[model samples]
Target: MATRLQSKWFRDNSRLQHCLVSDPHHVLRGATGEHVSLIQGALSILDGSRIADDEQKRHLYGPTTENAVLEYKKRRRIINLLYQTQADAIVGKMTIRRLDEEMKAQERSRSHLMFAVGVSLPEPRMVILSETANRDFVGWANQMVKLYSGKVVKVDAATDPAEEVKRIRQAVNTAGAGGLLILSVGHGVCIPQFGEQGTFDLAPNAAMRVLGKNYNENEPKDFVSPYYDDKPAANTGLKPLSQKDKDERDQTPGAQRRLKNWALWQEVCKIFVDGKLSAVVLLTCRIGGAPLFLQKIAGQWRTKMIAYKDQVGCYQTASGRFRTILGKDKDKTAPPPPPHTNTPWGEITIPLSMTDMVVIDPPAAPKTP
Candidate 1:
């Protein structure tokens, strides 16, 4: 396992270094059996570029060279040695200096260190009410954030929710790191905005009603522009549009705009809609907790935890799964009797690496009708 991990790490680092500074000729001659074809293709491309110094090119890609020779031998394929000898004879010394320069030009693009900040939920009521749940979130988040010098702001848990959200949003926008990691862990529910449920329909006039011709963020007082530009005289109770039309209107700019409510789902949704997040890990038990903001960019990667019971606490099968939860108590005491209440409980899950295990209570599931 250690050997495999080390090799994987080396390969990953090599790939990273390649992205940072790649030699075009080194790239041109990559495989063992494909040497002839690769060389022909490279020469065709290089010939067009007017690359001078044939000897340098030979050393760069020719079969007699160390890299090409090794690559050829690795494939267990031996071909015309006369062609190799002929190329070696005509080629001069002195490796190409321009390819090295080109490689150096791409150095800045190969950064691996990443920084991210994640928030479970920005609402105060939900976090404070669920203390154990909050601990789980804090423990898991702090562990992950330590890798990147990042911070996790518990909005509802904090003294001032508004101030915390503001600070968090600012940090997220200015992190200036490789990628921003954002998590919105909480319950999710859809609301009827203009009587539409998950409707994607939008019209030009409805769009204008929601977003306006020239929307300005500078106008703090005029935060939400009125749905209607002009109201009819006196007894005119004529609605602006049908519920379906109004739904379309609400869906337009409101879909992109900052949410009006401070719901847990909305807080998580705000992070994605704000448009600074690179990767988001939703810890909510249910799907569709947060909209897919960076979905296509990251594809299908996710942080999933599966729990199983052991002697004391539950254990996760994946490596380093329960490490965060298995912490040493300052004063370890004898285990207390299990709760007497008829609580449908689950065991505490810890990683397999740890020696000690402890029991913990999970948040009670809501009773179904």
Candidate 2:
């Protein structure tokens, strides 16, 4: 197993000076003493009887050193193959430069640092009722946010969806771009528009309405009635509305309203269109499975999206799955778990291209020991 090291350790190349090839004349082949030892140590190839036979302290240009150099040359050839270039067995400035480049690449690959934004269904909308479930979801979301170095922006249920979107946009703008926006909502529904073939419409506050149905056995209650009946003309049961009454009713100011999914999608696109956001992950129930819906937004925004391809269960299940992906804490001694599984509860990545939706299936369950 490869031990993880700090980035600074690799960034500082001074430690490699002793092992680095200095003299142009002192090459690996037919080189005796410290030269052979230094080259072998630099490449981390400790596989020879001569290397273990340290009692003599004699660095002889033996078969062991030659074999190590040969192996190193072969590795370089493999790298050259990738670039469609001819490979030479000799090590020189070119080889040292490639090694340095590889170290820098390693440093980048090991960096888990990131910045992110987390958005979740607020208050009444997230009526899971179970405190444990809610806590687990919040914890899991926070864990992911921390893993990516993000901050959570709470959106209250009382706030209009449009206003929430505006706030999020402002936050992204203020934070200065190139991060993630993670949205955890309820079930996603597609409403068809009359003339729009690929576009889907949505009723105001659709997430609350749809999610409420899952939480309650009774009919989903509304924050306010869609119809307005507070006017004085209603006293006359069958009377026609006067122009003045109509104007007054139209002028009457009401509460701010939530936007439909299409409107929400538009708002999201506006924020991410300039490549400000590298990725978006919708942690909702069924949005991942909606290919048409996902394709419509992904195609327009050109941002990658990670979402579930099936109905993600309650917060508990969602959190559990996230923990599994991030790795379990208990049994750190055990081998690392596979990233993918065969379960229906897998994450799918919708790329910028409409045709290339990649599904990462879950790995099979481990057999009993």
Candidate 3:
């Protein structure tokens, strides 16, 4: 089951420059270093454009990387079955060796949808984050959009959410037909009351301007989502929120914003005139932990979701394998596979399509007129 991918980037074309470590030393998700680069490099050569960046030297295991791992494991049936029932997507002994097996040969090519669309609009007031401070994410998003979103449409996620929705609908219409894919980038947040309905912060700052600064900012709402399953899973330690818990979180800021985004998705969902958009990729962090939230949001968009369940960041050391300029990774060429999967925590989850979130270095941004 070796991947059909063929590339010279793979070391010697028979084996990776670095080996995928065994258990304990296994490279799970949330990892960053040279070892990760090795894994990403191999996958890139083995899987074609599937990795986020074809030459992902950043070496951070984000959603795209995690999904690739899951896909690789699934295709090769690398599950041990002794410990876990299904492919967990974590890069342990079995997973790595399986990926290694494909390093030696070349075969068919995998076709992917490079036409996904991305929509990101943070509060207009928020400054463009130091592009370097969040380079890993910025780069990931930039690359993912570039590689997968062959047809790019420009929309500001304008301060007026309603307008943003209108613009997105227009993008979908003009982008042509087929499975529609979208990337929602920016801050992701969760209210304990709706922990399972985790939402993003794309609301305009104008909505928050009138709210008092000293008021209870952590209070919860009575909000309930149709797709949210409050019942805890049979054995998962996770529990439902009590009234006290909800009260504590209701005062939080951004509730309206999250709600607005929720409504916005409803509108976005309705825009599926041709077919369900391939998937709504959430480039935000930690949303994957809330499966129910994903379900609800996806339901709103009438599509599946791909999201992460952790604080997505790559490491940067003065002498680290992945160096940074100012703060961004110095090397801007490369792609990655998807991630450390969901255990008590989570990896990027693709409810339907298990693997398709690779990220290669994106072409430079176009000059704005």
Scored by TM-score, the top model is: 3
- Write model 3 residue lDDT over 44-93, tens digit each, in one string: 54564365643243457777888888887777777777777778757775
* Model 1 lDDT per residue over 81-165, tens place: 6455322211111112222232223212221111011112221111111112444444544443442232333222222334444
Candidate 2 clashing pairs, residues 3+ apart or interchain: 33-59, 340-362, 340-363, 341-361, 341-362, 341-363, 342-362, 342-363
* TM-score of every candidate: 0.28, 0.36, 0.41
Candidate 3 structure, TM-score to reference: 0.41
lDDT of 3 at 35: 58
Off by over 4 Å in 1: 1-4, 7-133, 148-161, 189-237, 241-281, 287-320, 323-369
By lDDT: ranked, best first: 3, 2, 1
Worst 10 residues of 2 by lDDT: 122-131
- Report residue 100 deviation for candidate 3 (angstroms): 10
Query: By summed lDDT, which 10 consecutive residues of candidate 3 come out lowest?
Result: 342-351
As a whole number from 0 to 100, the lDDT of residue 216 in candidate 1 is 37
The TM-score between candidate 1 and the true structure equals 0.28
